[model samples]
Target: MTNFLPMTKDDMSKRGWDQLDFLFVSGDAYVDHPSFGPAIICRLLEKSGYKVGIIAQPDWRSTNDFKRLGKPKLGILVSAGNLDSMLNKYTAAKKYRSTDNYSPGGQAGLRPERATIVYCNRIREIWKHTPLIIGGIEGSLRRFAHYDYWSDSVRRSILVDSRADLLIYGMGEKQIKEVAAQLSAGISIENIRDIAGTCYRTETLEHLWDYIEIPSYQDVVNSKKDFANAFKFQYLEQDPIRGKTLAQGHGEQFVVQNQPAMPLTTPEMDEIYDLPYQRTYHPSYTAAGGIPAIQEVKFSIVSHRGCYGSCSFCALYAHQGRIIQARSTESILREAQEIVKMPDFKGYIHDVGGPTANFRQPACEHQMDRGTCRGKQCLFPNACKSLDTSHTEYLQLLREIRKIPGVKKVFVRSGLRYDYLMAANDMEFLRELCEHHVSGQLKVAPEHISPKVTKLMGKAGKETYLKFKKAYEKVNKDLGKEQYLVPYFMSSHPGSGLKEAIEMAEFLRDTGYNPEQVQDFIPTPGSLSTCMYYTGINPLTEEKVYVAKTPHDKRLQRALLQYRNPKNYELVREALVKAGRQDLIGYEAKCLIRPPRNKQNIAVSQPENWNKKRRLAPSRTQHSKTKQTRKI
Candidate 1:
């Protein structure tokens, strides 16, 4: 029978089972949609001839909630929800956010900080021998010893803190399959250390082969130089084709990560997403307004996974990897047909894309056999000659979805890499994109326009965005459509300073763009930019980079993005004067902000004070595959 995995003891009883083979514990409320990681993992296990039940957002104050399903026959899988717990609970400014989109009714405080550790510790107090496995964004990104921005220190790998028997780094289906099979065959969790994309801790590294050793946890904590070096080593070796096993010492023990699992093939992607997902939050959550995060993705089709954009601030490179694995056109159409039958679907199909919507294949021919050219990016500084910039497959997929019966408008909400589209040999994708796919405004991420800052961000040059903008305008002009392009901008990245901030403000002024969506960089762990933010050195170049560390600098940079706003007038005026661009403070049409009308001082609200006003956790403002925290 197609149903939600057991969430309560009575659910198991109804399923005619006294115990489950695996107990899945997630920090988010259980929403059995394929988009949610916990649901995917549990559903995948169920399809593989194993029994799995989810214990979503359990109360960690006591072990009772953890014990509701009793000890699993084989193991327990832990995840910190779709988004990381800390990032889910707080805003970029490090203030308590009142809403958690993953929680039921958008409630807060259901999960504790560092949820994996707390949950695992609670599980251990009762069932010490049951195998514990941790994965998902929080555990995967923190699989190594890395910097923690909230604590202002380098913490050990999550494996050490959670005491999990194993850590699966990437999207963990392949690793989980192997572990489950081994466990089912009477293999112990202690001996299941050699699987690809899995991490295990040991007192010795003698059993490992073809491995590289990174800086020990102590070295990273003590020396910023070592910290940069350690991050650089791990950054370049993320490819499955060329990546090697990595070992890092933490005190007398070591955390060893095997080579990443191979990217899922088209058939594999089809099956995983096709699993019988209930496609909504549990029925038990109906009264509290259900999960807010599922609203966007419930009717949306995830056409693909992974990205190669290599934006410095994004963790997709670390989590989903660069390889593009997409579902077959038939599979996507099948899902679309299913959505058409849903009770609440309406006629509009919310989205039909994933990561980079336009990306339908690997960046180049060599990626499948030789891996991504080690440190070089396919779309950075300039588009690589070997890069394949075709949108033919994706455009056809969209056309087919539009043809589906009872479907009206289909929008491409996933980010479209404009630089890639601009570099393509065909203009049909851009033309068709503007005419058919756009829903009035197409959102693109042009994080920064400053050459130096863009260079550090691993983004295309300003010329690319400019050229694409003209093309988009021309396309909409020919189609007689008045569509708009909403460009997402970020402030206070590692390489951005007052000079760069003033330049962005000037670009906004000249372009007449008053950004409602602004991303102030939050240095989350497991990203190259976070490494630079901590050590003041770009891991890629090993050269010194300017980091805006102080609250004063962050305020000025963020305020500059919205210079025309009345609330940001003081900060913007002060920034212009600090940059020696006092000419921009006058009443001229080109000036970013006008001189104060009256000398009377006005109190402006800071981020901490402003977050006090309750708000839902906003959608993706940062340049990440995962929807991470942004300014409230």
Candidate 2:
């Protein structure tokens, strides 16, 4: 059948099944699109001859709403939606957000806080002995007893907190299939702990063989050095091929995480995307303005998975691993053909890329067998010697996508790895990208121009960004195009102080671009940057770093990015003065802002008695005359 899987009891009856084999509960509203992780996992289960039903965003106030789908015959699958629930609900300041893109109608607060723990606990309350499996960004990233930025302390593993029988970390396709097969064969959840990409709590160490034991939960919480050492080891062992089983003790019990699952091959990636997907939100949500997250990716194509960039603030390494697994060109073209047939299809295909648009293959040949280097990065600290810098295949694929009928333009909306592109030195791809892909503006993240800050953020030096900017301008000039590079910068990241923020502001002043929006570093879980923010030490190097923790400093740093805005005039001047740059506050061309509108200067420029007498109330005629006089 081409319809969505059973979502309610009536739909289950129509399927002629007494009970579903698996019940998937998600924090997001039901959307059967491929980009949503719940939809992908549920559909993959159905394709394997298992009956799966979805209960999305169920009322978590009690177990009554969870019983709507009834108990499953085999197990319950729970995901805290696509993005991490904490990240979706709170800003860096730990303030509640006003809009949730994953909810119906983009509503906020549709799901509870710490959604995975809430959903899993609710299932346990009713089902008693049923297998509760937790997988998603929230669960995967917090699988270990790492830091919790929201809680502001080191919490135990989610496997301990959620009371889940099994925790599937990372991309869970391979792990999900394995769990389904074992559960179908009547295996106990406790006995199924040996599978890769899974975590479970155990009382004894007998089940774990040849594993590395991370620091005990109590020790990590008490000692920053111990936590940094533990994280460094965990980061190194993330490679699927060379990774070892990792175990961490939580008082009397232990949370054991197995080696990461292997990366999918090209054919496997193609098969995963070729599966039947409704490719849109369930029609039941039409009245609630439909699911807001689907609009961005409904017409887009995901050509690959995983990223090699490994930025410090990003969690892709811990979740998707470092290797790149891509779908075939034929599969991409097939998806494009399907998009052309949609009734609402416009001539534009929004994006034809993945995590990083330009990264289409592994960094080197050794990565597949030996795994990513333990202590080294692929693109940072200069590209590795064995890195593959070819864009020939990706260039050809984009060209083919453009040739498809009904496709007027194909844009690469994902952030391009500028350092990677610079490594390629391929003018043809750059030429095609400048002429065809860019829509008057291309957004690239250089983060900050300060060498001290960029190094701490795991980004290339300012020299690399400058080289790319020059090259981009040359290409546009040659093509007779007016496209511009809108660079992304962050404020208040570790290693960024008032001095570094002012340095970035000077770079912005020179470049003639004012950022409309700025990102303040929010210390989310499973990131190196968050570790530094919490412990004041870089985990990789064990060096004490500067972190802007006060709200006053953070606001001052953010205001420097948009120093031209008159609303931020006082804040910008304050930052400049505080950073020992008081010389930059005068009427010089290089000054960030005029010296706070001096009253003496205003008196000289204004009419004789402009502020001599302040009027609290005025007649309509007087108000009109005052407004006209001020304008003159």
Candidate 3:
């Protein structure tokens, strides 16, 4: 009972099982913790009285590694790990990353690029008749014809490319369990298309009713405008209550996505989190340094799931949906107590929330009966009147966790929606957060300071962040604490041009804070921002937006965010001059960077064989006034 599900045939024989009910293939090293998606799915299947085997990070070059557990009697469940495999391998700049935190020993390149497609193709080679189900972030996001940032082209749905029988979008706990039961009950995978939160390929749409038909696959590839339109249609129908079935043509067959599954109730969420998770990597990985991703969440507790923040660049809406489902208070406190007993528990809880930390309930009561509003967000532009912004329950939960014996400090490492916090009528929660929860510095993602860019990103106005900043400072001052705020900003987001980046640089200069790292926008699939980035038009508004496409322009925009750094000074200067704001290059108090050191500095800063004219009159020389001080 203390052992993990069989990973090898010898272990399988010891379990006295002839054939598994399911074989779960994953792109990440197996860490039997609730935070790992494959772990949660496999445990759910196991608890449902199924013999589930795991094949983690298999060699994709051939089918040998995939056949280790043999084929399951019911089906094959495939996932591209917890993260999108492309994102795992490449940075926003499309450069190969050196380490993969989800792998054993934090090794890179253990999982192949596009792991889901590779795994499914291999399974097809050995077991052609078994049901193939693809899920997780990579498959879910690419369940539709999506723009592949790594390839710079629109690709067909993963269902088509992987040739899997089904793709479970969003969190697949409910969907996967239902599929398993139906399959066990002697239903064919192709016949199990009526379930919610699932996609399947079919040759005919005669049986479907009241579904929205998006543009065909070839149409999206032929026109970026059509792709934008298709995305908008998909975006409006993500809700479980009011969403309709979506059908898109792929050659002779069609990919149909049913309406999203209803969000898990509080008790359902509690039950899932309460399952017997080993809460760590298996003992087999002890020699390989264990999975590095577990270290971040080992002491943390996920109090909830789903986010209503709905930032344009985030895929939470597509993957987790907008409905918030949280574990009960009693359930969370129980987990905290369990953490306190851990041998590695050093009197601190790393994090206490998920997605958005302060969100303990839905945006409003109606979202339970009706789904999240279409074409509108709960907290973007302005907080909706129906938005139930309260902190009483969450504040009480935090207080209770802090009082747990042996738990010295309960920190909230997850990002908190500052605008939501500001919506609360009372400042007591904010006061408590500053005094106890903040660990010297609290990180908040303001993303950008310009109103234009923030609006395009579906974030609150710049004024909201400024207001929260003042309130945070006031609370810290009253508590006699020197806590600081670390605001995260992005560069080269759609609708942000040189002028906007320059304005952001000025904002940073005035605030007197220098950020060491800046995020350049990467157009990940399934986000509204990616739509805008690909089509040059906001999918929601149908208005053209400026996108920094060239490497030179993107580098300039990123440099503006960290203009204080010595290396970025030249890039910042070049950007300022290009934007015709040369005033920002001088030695003035508000200037972002000083004039280049000397003529030699200019030569070194300019690009190779550069012949552009010297922009700001040569670096002004500093003159000693000792001899000229006679004038009163």
Off by over 4 Å in 2: 599-632
lDDT of each: 0.87, 0.87, 0.88
Model 3 bad stretches (over 4 Å)? 597-632
Estimate TM-scores for all models: 0.94, 0.94, 0.94
Worst 10 residues of 1 by lDDT: 614-623
Candidate 3 local distance difference test against the native = 0.88
Q: lDDT (0-100) at residue 391 of candidate 1?
A: 85
- Which tens-of-lDDT digit does each residue in 221-287 have in candidate 1? 9999999999998999998999989999999999999889999999999999899988999988899
lDDT of 1 at 94: 87
For candidate 3, the per-residue lDDT at 620 reads 10
In candidate 3, residue 356 scores what lDDT? 90
| TM-score of decoy 2 | 0.94
